[model samples]
Target: MNDSARAKPLPTPETQHYWDGAAAGELRLQRCQACSKAYFPPRPFCPACGSRGVRVFAASGKATLYSYIINHRAAPGFTAPYAIAVVQLAEGPRLMTNIIDCPQTPEALVLDMALEVAFQKLDDTITLPVFRPAGA
Candidate 1:
């Protein structure tokens, strides 16, 4: 599918840094300074302690395949048989993404399989952080 046909992300002030990091080939996440907990879906306040002291930093880009589902039905921007996955980042946060560079099958996408971040640039401003086998 073409880039224009894909559903793009709308970057907000709270999440702008994340999108920027993806464009730079780095996976960035927010950590609560007060609680020292890493989290996804960036926000000004820490969800654990309600503290507004949150810092954005580069993630290790290392993750594991926590869970996934193979979608047989195609969407506007996605092809069928794609794995919609939840990857657990090394820092303790999980994010929904697509698994690429591998066959989309249950036997192939094993739970706890090592994976790493792979950016998919949808446009000049929107780059998605997908995942693939760690060494692939």
Candidate 2:
């Protein structure tokens, strides 16, 4: 596959902080000052209470394997049998991401397994935050 086939995240004003944090090797999330709830996939307002009083904070790069599927069919720029996962972050939010640095099998992709962030730079300005078994 060519680089053009790879899907890249475009940073918008609401999500620019997220992309910038990824580029700087940090996991930035927004917390509502009104209700003290933190959320992800960056939004202009707090998802919890619809409050505009949100603040960006760095999150620990810790998460647990929530759920996943082993995709055995090739698609776009990905190889077959890759795990598409939803990881529950320590900060109370879940993200859909790909697991890396381990065998893509049920035995290896255990639910509730500990994970840490791993950034894969797609270009000069875009970095994807994948996860791997923590300490692997």
lDDT by residue (1-136, candidate 2, tens digit) is 5666978888988899999988999889889999999898899799879999999999998999999999988778888878999999999999999999999999999999999988888888998888999999
Per-residue lDDT value at 123 in model 2: 88
> Per-residue alpha-carbon lDDT of model 1 for 59-132, expressed as tens digits?
99999999988999867787787899999999999999999999999989999999999999888888999999
* Cα-based lDDT at residue 52, candidate 2: 96
lDDT of each: 0.92, 0.91
Q: What RMSD value applies to candidate 1?
A: 0.9
TM-score of 1: 0.96
Determine which window of 10 residues in candidate 1 has minimal summed lDDT.
1-10
Candidate 2: Cα lDDT at 121: 85
Q: In model 1, what are the clashing residue pairs, if there are any?
A: none
